[model samples]
Target: MREWHADYLDACNRHDLDAIRSFLSPSVRRAHLPSGSDAWIDDLAELFTAFPDWRWRRVQLIAEEDRLAVHLRAGGTHAAAFRGIAPTRRHVNVAEFAMYRVMDRRIAEYSGTGDHIELLAQLHGGLPT
Candidate 1:
């Protein structure tokens, strides 16, 4: 199970949408709680398009039976608008935590949290020194 999770993270780092989807069941139910969003598949496909160079680095991963929780950092240059924010062309890295519900060895649901304020601040002119 940990190996599967590692592979999924690797796929995310690679920004391979198809490879990432391979870890999801056909009927996967995705829940992006932070934004109150849901989907059957392609949950994060749009994010890739927004941050073309986005990447994730896992800080830690914990698994308890069918559920897995991960602490990680995700970042990329703001090359395009996201959630209505115009492109900033600045690099931003933010810490994020996510929980995944696995079913039949696939991710059936996912909920994550991140510091949007920090991200937004960075997009404007980066963090204050």
Candidate 2:
């Protein structure tokens, strides 16, 4: 599982959407996003467009049976608008955490949170009111 996850992260780091899609089940459910992998892929595409150099580094990973959890540090330069905020060309790094349920060696379901408040603050130069 560790090796598999490493490969998955590598694919993500490369921004290889097709490779990333190969790691997800057709019916994969991303609890925070829409119901399927297509929506998840679209979301990633938007992020890539907004931050062409976006990257994620794994801070921690834990696996037990069919479950896996990870802590990640995500960083990117604001080269394009995001979530109604215009580009400020600032770089931001934020923490993200996620847990996955794997079935048939593909991610079946997952839920996670990213430090969006911190990201917004970094982009806006301070916490928003």
Whose TM-score is greatest here?
A: 2
After superposition, which runs of candidate 1 have C-alpha atoms over 4 Å from their true positions? 32-43, 114-118, 124-129
Each candidate's clash count: 0, 0
Residue-level error in angstroms, candidate 2, position 33: 2.1
Q: After best superposition, candidate 1 residue 7: deviation in angstroms?
A: 0.6
List clashing residue pairs in candidate 2.
none
Q: Given candidate 1, what's the lDDT at residue 95?
A: 86
lDDT of 1: 0.73
TM-score of every model versus the real structure? 0.78, 0.91
Per-residue lDDT of model 1, residues 1-129, tens digit only: 789988988888887767876787666544444222234223365566667898888899999999999998888887877777888777788888878889887777766674256777777676841
14-125 per-residue lDDT for model 2 (tens digits): 9999999998998898875677779778878888888899999999999999999999988899999988899989888888898999898889998888426678888888
